[model samples]
Target: MPIIKSKIFTKSKKTSSFFITILFILSFLLVFINKADLYIGSKIKTVSADIASPIIYFLTFPFDKSISAIQNLNSLKNISIENNKLKEEIKILKQWQSLSLKLINENKAYKELLNVNDDTFETLETARVINKAPNIFANIIQLNIGLNKNIEINSGVLNERGLIGRIINIGNVTSRVLLITDINSSIPVKTLNQDINAIISGQSDSILLKLKFIKENKMPKIGEIIVTSGNADIFPPNIAVGKIYKIEDNIYYVKPFVNFKELEFVNVITKKL
Candidate 1:
């Protein structure tokens, strides 16, 4: 019994030492990894994402369908209320529509007289939002369409409400969208009534975006509609972005039309190159 116990103790000690040695080596390797700029973590993340993306898509498919169905039902429920509001709006819009048509015809006549010709075309592509970043600091979403669908970088993304954001990164079957609420985002905008031009810049944690490049004397009024001016042609002209939310101490802020958290689908406008 004593010899048996001695042999067992020897084996146990060797096993424990073996594990301890392994743990020490692993600790050193991890410390070295943390200190060195080997970029191994980046590579690992890329590989893991590539392997896990399809699995995630399949897992979330049913949930997405359910959400879409619920949205449709809610929309149906609100249709009557919206219809009543639209009826009143349409009555006012018809008068403007008639004037707009008359003005368009007059403008065409003037352009013809001046021998000026302008022709431009735009195409829109649809993409599904597959993933949304839960981090408040990073206001971004991932789309299911990418290079396969010819989705170009920096293409304007929007829903029915108005301009949302632009494409930032593209992968094989996915793309990342930097929302208008992201700190890195900026857009050229103009107020509808005053025609006061300014740049809209995003905030880190706030949904109300900042208005820049506006003169203090030309502050846009509250409730004024803001739209893309296409100053640099980054986005198409006259795309409704949002409304002026507040003006205080020579500062202007806008409330976005599209709720960033609730986005499911978007239209990517691909301009002709």
Candidate 2:
């Protein structure tokens, strides 16, 4: 009895598998028949597209979104990198703009200096300021041009703005300049409007020049333009010196046109006939 029951169970399992296979084959045949039938082919295809396409899309939706998200992340990172690079370039351009503006203003001043009236048999030699004493009281500077350039002792040194100093010591390839603001230095100056004569002298560490030799009864008015008087022959006559800044304690002071702290280049009078 037990053997018969086992055989029956095995037979039943095989029969069930055979029916499943047959059903699968029949389902495929039915689909192929519907596709081959001209009357039903279009209708069946339409139905499959409408129903199966949405089911397929739903199954793949998460994977497609993940790929799109990855692409978007890479694009954002690239944009950030490009933006930072642009910022650095803009900063450099701004610095260049500032430097260019300074040069432009300097050029305009040079044009005006060349237009000044002068009648002297002199040759101008341009030189760069190589060194300067920190103490304004010393008022000494060094130039790159020397005897080779025909630079002479007591020769007038000026720039586009006005007179800076005179060559006091000469060397083979360098020269020492004594600025007008030195204590031991003095230059004869005259007012442009009044023709009043005075001597402009420097005090230790002072930016203002002391006006001397004016009559006790005469006081120079404020804002009078002073020029070289050509008395000592150190500088040409009518060379710009400074303007009368103020008068106090029975002393008149003139402010020089050139700012000594920012001095860079100067023109040395190589010859004055």
Candidate 3:
């Protein structure tokens, strides 16, 4: 055992001594090179840079690429957040624009209603249309005002355009208005251009009104306006009703000035119950 230990120690000492001698020789050469030339120092620096450049690039290339990728991802995240905020702002602006349009239309309708200045009505009440649905009554509409507002039966109903319908049933808070388009509705009317009197009756399952009992001697022309004659004292005189658009087979179809689909507010102006 001791013999093997001594052999290992001798080999280690020889290896150490050889490295020390080589280092002493290199140190002496370094001093000689220092005195060699200023240009030699520059050449050594150039060679050292050539060798170290590739090693430095190899070490830093992956790190630089990783940093660039991370920066790009952060920029994309910021762009996404900004886009979401812009979308939300646009949505809110659109909602306000829609509401503004609705108000403008409603205001225009109200102005049209104000133009219906009737001087013959003893009682005038503004009513809101609550329901207009299809039923056994072909063209029936319900109003918000009824007996509570002293709304009378057989009273006249009109919109901004002209006379639309009449009141039939009166409740405490609501009333059933029989639209002029109903099959049973018949109004005594006279032509605007001529004094030809006739009964404007509603046709079954149709929106147009029919003129009946016109005197053979007085034939009215197309485009003549029709107004109430106040014969039965139900609808007042000179109240606008409809226009004669077409006349076929001795039957004249009158297109009412009131648009049933857009009838939102109305005026009930006549005698009360």
Candidate 4:
């Protein structure tokens, strides 16, 4: 059995060797053919670049453009937001500027009121309005000045336009003014046109003092100016009170120069006649 197996192995080895030789020859021929036809370094590099460059460009072109567009859009949005913020800031500053101008004009008006000349009402003290009475029936105002500022009871209070009121009550640091429109208020007034003496009496809020004691035939006409007579030591002569607005048969009414609703400052004449 060993002899028979040895013979079979020898016959198979020849066939196997022939097949191996053919395979080696075929592999060598393929290698030589590939080397002769194509370059390994430069040619492979050129082909790879040609293929990859187009793919890279195709993938990155739109992405780069989109990135640039996004950056430009963000810049524009930032600029728009900043511009709006600046506009708002400018608007607020303009409001403040307008307020400052108004305050300056008001101060100038107050200074001019203080410089008013009157020898009879020599002693003068300035006071700022602080508050008003609660009801329409009580025409009283609270002032920042009081006895501490040399303001006394019965002190005449007047503004730039005309006579305002009298200081009826005085505290240490505050005083109460009784407006001329109060029912209890009474002052001697004279018409500038005819120089007719009359007693001015308060009626209501809108309607100020009515000129009394004038003869029915000698009533003042509408628009005639009324002024203090100086007969009473309480008020100075020639101080403008108001202008006549209406005359009904024998009675005449005058509208005050100063608007009590808009009163801000007043001068308290502390002089004793």
| Top TM-score model | 3
Candidate number with the higher TM-score (1 or 2): 2
Clashing pairs in 1: none
List lDDT for all candidates, in order: 0.80, 0.83, 0.85, 0.83
Candidate 2 per-residue lDDT, tens place, 109-162, comes to 555545544676264567778998776565899999998987788998887778
What shift in Å separates residue 46 of candidate 3 from its native position after superposition? 11
The TM-score-based order of candidates, best leading, equals 3, 4, 2, 1
- Which whole-number lDDT from 0 to 100 does residue 217 have in model 1? 68
Q: What is the TM-score of each candidate against the true structure?
A: 0.53, 0.63, 0.65, 0.64
Expressed as tens digits, the lDDT of each residue in 192-214 for candidate 1 is 88888889989979988888855
Descending-lDDT candidate ranking:
3, 4, 2, 1
Q: What is candidate 1's TM-score against the reference?
A: 0.53
Q: Local error of candidate 3 at 155, Å? A: 0.2
Candidate 3 — which residues are off by over 4 angstroms? 1-91, 111-115, 134-138, 271-273
The CA-based lDDT of model 2 is what?
0.83
The window of 10 residues in a row where model 4 has the poorest summed lDDT is 213-222
How many residue pairs clash in each candidate at the backbone level? 0, 0, 0, 0
Model 4: residues with Cα > 4 Å off, grouped in runs: 1-91, 133-138
Candidate with better lDDT, 1 vs 4: 4
